[model samples]
Target: MRILALALAGAVLGATSALANGDALVIGNSRYTAVQTLFGAQRVAQAASALNAKGFDVTLVQDADAADMRRAFGEFAELLDDDGGPVVILLTGAFVHSAGGSYLLPVTGNGRIDEAEVLMQGFPLDAALAILSAHQGRAFLVLGETGEDPDLSLYLNAGLGELDIPHGVTVIRGPAMDVARYAARDMARTGRFVRRAAIEYELQIEGYAPQGQVIVRAGDVAPPRGAIDPPLPDPFANRAADDVAWRLAQEADSAEGYQTYLDGFPGGVHVNAARQRLSALNAEPFYRERRAEEDLELDRNDRRAIQRALTILGHDTRGIDGVFGDGTRGAIRRWQEETGLRVSSYLDRDQIARLQAQSTRRAAELEEEEKRQQAERARQERVFWRRVEDRGEEAGFREYLQKYPEGRFADEARAVLKAIDAQRAEQAVGQDRRDWTKATQANSVAAYNAYLRDWPNGGFREEAKQRISQLQLDADRVRNSIEASREEKAMNLNFVARQLTERRLEQLGMKPGKVDGQFDENTRAALRRFQDARGLRVSGYLDEQTMVRLLAGGIIGIDR
Candidate 1:
């Protein structure tokens, strides 16, 4: 009886070793150091237990930092053997993406995830895809997205963006809660058809998944006699030929070269790497120009110099803050187009030097032109003063002062005009002086009209007519301003739109105070300045035309 019990123990231990079938890595991050915590992300840890039950080696981490996540990936990679089997990786947390690729972010970074941080710290989805590609038909990646849309900096966006899936890896993605439930219950179940489960859960499945594909089988089932299962082609069968072709392709390092290799050996071991390089080469049309600019390794001061040069050349880089954002890129593209160069929106070393030289030349030319204009203006002022001095009339002196208020003979011109006005006043009658004084004191259209009626052809007749004209114009302007205010109110812009308007005004250097969606005196002044600059109606209110120009196209529906 003791020998039989020992034999049973040995059999159990042997079966347990034989059942080890695959490797799995599950990382679920819920708490964050900077941004809002993703509440349901940590629940995805249940998937680790489910995968372990299916005879899979699982490594699970929760709320992992960058170093912790990297170590987990390395450990998981070491578990993979040459013999292909099922491979599963599940990641649930904040995600940010750019044109390059999607990234699974760790919980320890700042809220504003820039492109540099993403490349250095974030776990690239493409790297996971590359690893999965080696296993072909037996690879799976499940992504659970926390629907928190934090503001990622310039080139990054919040969410799992569009993916470039490899040839034979399957990807399943959904919201964090739904993905957690699906991963534990259906995805880890033995003998479950992944496609049917995905359909039932309403999850999005992408890349290479055929019908009836199962990750784990129920048990070993023998086939009937003479019924043969088709064998998958071995990835390393023609290693010598594949190696030579891959070497030639890498040496060429062109899209066409990679394409030739792919066409020759579709199932080769280096196929995944070749496809990744090919995709990157083809994705950006100006990849060479962009790479050339990046190779310069420009510092902040260098970027600011480029912006100053662009602005001096009248390209309007928006601001010279040393950040090459969309405005700077657009300015660069425009400058390149005008200078008869490639409009790639990226500047090489030679281009930067040329821009600096052109700006320096332009600055000198502008200075010289300004000096010439100043000399010419002085000569014209002298000639006009000579003509006015020869005439010596009140009208001539007034016209001379109107044209050049600070001319060389301005004090002489004003003295002579004042004396002429006093002599005219002395020549007028006592009652005429009294009536003109009354009209001037009242400073109204009716009062001026009364003064004109009392004394026709009086000394102040011209002055009274001018005053009436200005008063009438002022009345008309007041009516128009009131109508404009009503029109602005009718639009009924919401609080968020108001905030956006204020923010845009601030961006344009109008100095709208606070930007709290409250239209105060400062905000109105800013709106007026914006309107005045743009040649719109300067009523200190937002009309359709003002809104269009201020927002730089049209009123956008801002999310609250």
Candidate 2:
């Protein structure tokens, strides 16, 4: 079966009395709360009649939830004896497997199966194998697999996984339809070789397989006393009916169509194909809607355009990239909600056109509003500039420049301010030069201080301060002129340094006697006059301070 593997071994003797009283548990679950219904799963319950006819006691459960399945399994276990008879279990429904083991899902299980949930709530295949292992050669397990592969979580996988069959327990497995039909018709037939029936129905057999193994013996097991078998039907008529039902089911191609075929012919040959179709049809609820959108054959550019339109309509698509990810899907859902369409998060041709039209209208409105705003701003700027021009003051021009540096009349305002600044600067420069002249004529520290107070930022401010400092030093030197002269004599000026000093003093309009290195009376008078004019001590002797001022025009070397 699509569920698990089975291997048959050991032969059962025709005289075995244990076959007279076999115990069988049949569970068929089709209606599920979470996943697609296995339409033919419930038909496996029909196998109970066959098991009973073969002198076997059977317990049947259909569309069972977790609790019901557990109760049924418990009751079936209680009926078994340690060494009584053959044991059979027929399970039909959805199954999931993981690394741990396989489980038979109850009707209440969801699509997102977890390991703990499966282990706790679902019936473990291991439990079934354990029960069958006790009966050994006479044990039979028939699993009806749905053959549906669903998307489960990481810890679980849909469908029956590989089986770890216990020795001596025979397992018969195939698609739900094949297993169901085999269980109903061939599983309990007297003198029927189980392996031959498995091969005929294309079911897989695993564990305890032998050349010839029969689960039921004709002589050992008789139909219950007073139980009369029904008259056999015409084989030809049955085939004709089966063929007609299958053809009609194929033509309808719907869940109901295939279900009808299943109800009428549970053991029909097309039962497997019909159940497969039914499972597929019920699996996808939005099949038609998804197909309609896909038929549009949207390319990347088309998807991007749709995203842009959705964004313009105030739906945040997260990005304008061509890929339609979760954000884009959410945006589509919102748009569909507003537009009174199915909230499938997918687009049909008409819906796309409507979205485009709405976005176009919105864009036009925004453009008009923007243009009106621009016109209003331009009007405000003109009004402000007119006020500034009327004032015609430097402060007004500056204020206008601060407000709108790139306004239309900004250049004209700048030019006018530049000319006005130039005129004021010329007047200020004239006053500054007159003040400097007065300060020099006075030639005192107080005069330089007055000049600084008037023009703190004047161009000659640094020079004025320096002269004031030099004058103060000269006054201090005059008070100690003898000691100052003694310091100068100690300098021991050479002929070249003395000659350079005399020449520098003459160049300053203070005529020394000659360019010779001797300090004559003419040289002394020139030195005293130069010192008096330049704010230096006027001792009429070549002191260190006087020599420094005299040689200010160039470099000089002296020994001290």
Candidate 3:
């Protein structure tokens, strides 16, 4: 309940537009009698400011009384009207989670509040999600509980509550779940980490639609550069660290805005160094030189590059006019910090040369690295299959399938199996020698086939090439085993497959006849009909290829 320090700090500017764009509220309810409330207040204020500078509409309510807490919740509920975003809600307090539900004692309230005052003293997850759903935004609830607390799972089992992240809720207990931890992820500029943690649980719920909507990551770690950016407007209420990191990693503009962020935040954490490095590069004449090269194809030359450099430096470039005039130079210098690089408007050859070289190297390195990784993966796959053949082919293959479901060697394995089985049939009397020789020559291929035969449900699957290799041995007895499993195992239909089949049949002149909970012959017929109408190859099967086309055609409105 220590969110009341706003009285001393003055009402911080609520990033009205930023808040409205993607609302974030840092609620530091430090309810412990030992820990001072001001600590939570300051942390919330800093977090809110950091997020607001990054274009988030943030409200920092520190050390709030119960009435103030309720009012803040109401304001947050209003933010969901237009933006389907994640409204972050942080709580730092004593969490009394009984059979009824988990509750956070308001900071100003006494720690001894009994069960009778649970609803009044604490905010419930259901009420929070309901409010968030009504507002069109997601809710992320981060509960940083202190001291010796009961296991939340107890409450969960007793029907008090469950931590269903995808419903846009994340519940974290223990004083270890601090504002600094979240600040670190945000500082590291990783939001997907936070987003993933928020939504991962609900994504696994029995009947809940696993939209895989939120990206959640926990901890102070930063993701590798150029990793997939988290989805924007994260649909959760209170995000963990990754959410904060991702929000702060966003590019910004204006000297004043950046300076305000720096002022409020003295420590140069995750992004501070990146910002400084960018600023140093920006101040150097060569930074503009690289931009000029990248923009050389465009009509504007030096102007565009200069404007870009200035923007990167957190300077406002009215326009990239090519002319390195006073306005542009002044803006660049204003954006400069403690970097030793001399402030200059003119693009110098040395700086330009270095940036161009670095850029070229980075681009080439990225491409080559991608190719190298792909090749290495291919090589490993070959090796893995080879080992599988040498050992228990079926076991090797099964394990491989589990590890690499869409592996390239999948087809080869199938082919090897066909060959082995064929050799067994041709020389059914003494085909053992052929088996040893084939295993030695094409171990990976042999392993793959064995995997397909035994562990039909294994992660790795046979591709077109492997199936083609097995084409000659169509009548193999193992084929029946493979086909039999697909037919009998009703649970084989993946979530994507089920949704696609259901939605497509519903749209077409057919009412989805009992999603009969399985991919049976009826489902195949429906799939074939849909494929035939679309002029696609209709094999009366829903293969990955078919699923891809279905997705491309927007057969089902589910976001990919």
Candidate 4:
């Protein structure tokens, strides 16, 4: 029921399915009511899908009894059609060991025979494999279990421990090298998955090449002509098969060394593939081996793992190498002390697994913390802008310029400033217009002084000066126009006396007119008449005090 998102194109699927492959048979059993098969059933289906896709007419029989399994095996073996290639038998069920070699069990019912009765209840694993291998074509037997013997150590110690099988049987084990395993491990290993068992086998076979290649087998058919080449020193042809096997065996060091061997044997059958693997090997950092007598000190990979773990726990260890010499040990000890685990320099399997898991947990925690911090910074920025705006547009704009001179929103701030400036300028112009009218209507010199105090750089300075000059001229004309009235006569006589002699003008009641703002003879006669009325010598020109009196609302009533 696991949904796998495989990004392989249908074209690849179509191309793989069109390949002419030989016969293949797959057997799977999970409802045995014995040991719960976690991934066994799934693996069987996966195998079947992979084969089918690889242009193989794969026959997948699941949960079969003893009779059914034997019958299917017989039928598959009888297929002698020279169609595409060789016949392949892929069995993924339980293998039981007895005094008579190994046996493939049925779905239910024990394959065990008691002392009272002896019966061949189940098909023998070795016989089944042997029967398929005996054919005049290439054969393969893939299995996961090595042996389930508790005393495996004693057998290994005797140096006589090998579960023998056919020579061409290529075996793959564990929840490794496949998509689900790689994904669960976060290894990013496999890029795709083969849907059919035949295709899976093909891929396994073709994966032995440099580029990724998969092949599947269906029914018994003749193998393709160019598929099985004459064995030689062709590196490209065999690279995938060799690399996958090497990787599975955890012989990365040996595989890397093969790069040198391939380099030496350039004309070998697998030369191209060897060179490719060689290039890959050369790029990888050299991993040196330690002598048996050496101390149980940490290595680079160990240190890297530790560093990665420490980094997760908020300690920024630069790298993770297995070397727990001092820094890594110190970090581990610190983490152990914090987490209440045993504080030790040496890391056991459980400890290492814990460390790796902790590292991942710590990474997620760090990422979350960073996101929170960013959110806080953004909030603070918003608060700052709001506070500035509260101060008023001018202050806000000034603050913005100071804070972010080349900010993305600089243009927006400038626009706000420009609007405020324009508004202030418009208000200043309106006030200046009103001040100009008020200053013109005022008759006193104090009013003009007040207007000048209020508007230092008002726009109506020239207009106000002109209006004041005209008011002075009109006042002088009014005094000159009156010839018979006693006050007018006295004013004219005083004006004349002030105009004629400056000393006499001060003695007289009337002051002299200012020579400014007057051009006609009538203005001169008016000044002369005013001087005569005040009983002083006549002069048309006004004195400094007289001009001050004319300009500053100093009009006086004189005795006739």
Ranking by lDDT: 1, 2, 3, 4
TM-score of every prediction relative to native: 0.37, 0.38, 0.32, 0.29
TM-score of structure candidate 1: 0.37
lDDT per prediction?
0.68, 0.67, 0.44, 0.42
Off by over 4 Å in 3: 1-11, 14-20, 34-41, 109-111, 135-138, 148-161, 164-179, 184-191, 195-560
Candidate 1, residue 70: lDDT: 81
Kindly report which residue stretches of model 1 are placed more than 4 angstroms away from their true locations once superposed.
1-20, 31-42, 109-115, 220-560
Model 3 lDDT-worst window of ten: 1-10
Pairwise TM-score winner, candidates 1 and 3: 1
Q: Where does model 2 exceed 4 Å of error?
A: 1-19, 31-42, 109-113, 223-560
The sequence of per-residue lDDT tens digits that candidate 1 reaches over residues 94-191 is 78888889989876534445567677998989889989989889899999876555566788887898999888999998756557768867777878
- Report the C-alpha lDDT of model 4 over 1-560, residue by residue, as the tens digit: 11111111000011131344456666654324322122322344455445544444455555556666766676666653455354555554445554445555555544233311212655566665566555433454544331121222211221111345555443332211132222122211122322233233222332112233222323322244354553233233344444343222222323455565554555543344344334433543321211110123333334444554564565433222222333555666677787787665445556667877876665566446545764675465567667767776566665665454333355777787667655654656777767756766775566666677788666544334444554565566456444223332222233322333333333333333453333246555555544333233334444322332232221221111
Backbone N/Cα/C clashes per model:
0, 15, 49, 84
lDDT of 1: 0.68
Query: What is the per-residue lDDT of model 2 for residues 1-560, given as tens digits with 9 covering 90 to 100?
Result: 00110101000111111226678777776535432333333245347656665656666666556777787788788777554568899888778898888888776535444556667888888989999988888898889776444447778887788989998998888667567767767887888998899867657898888977888877657443332644333334446667567656744545788899999999876665566557656776754555466557564447657866786677766544444555678999999999888898878899999998987777666446545765786688789888988888776777776555445687997798778655654656788878988998999999999999999987556557656766875676566567656655644444655776687778767888788988787877787766655445666676644543333333333211
Model 4: ten consecutive residues of lowest lDDT? 5-14
Error of 1 at 301 (Å): 54
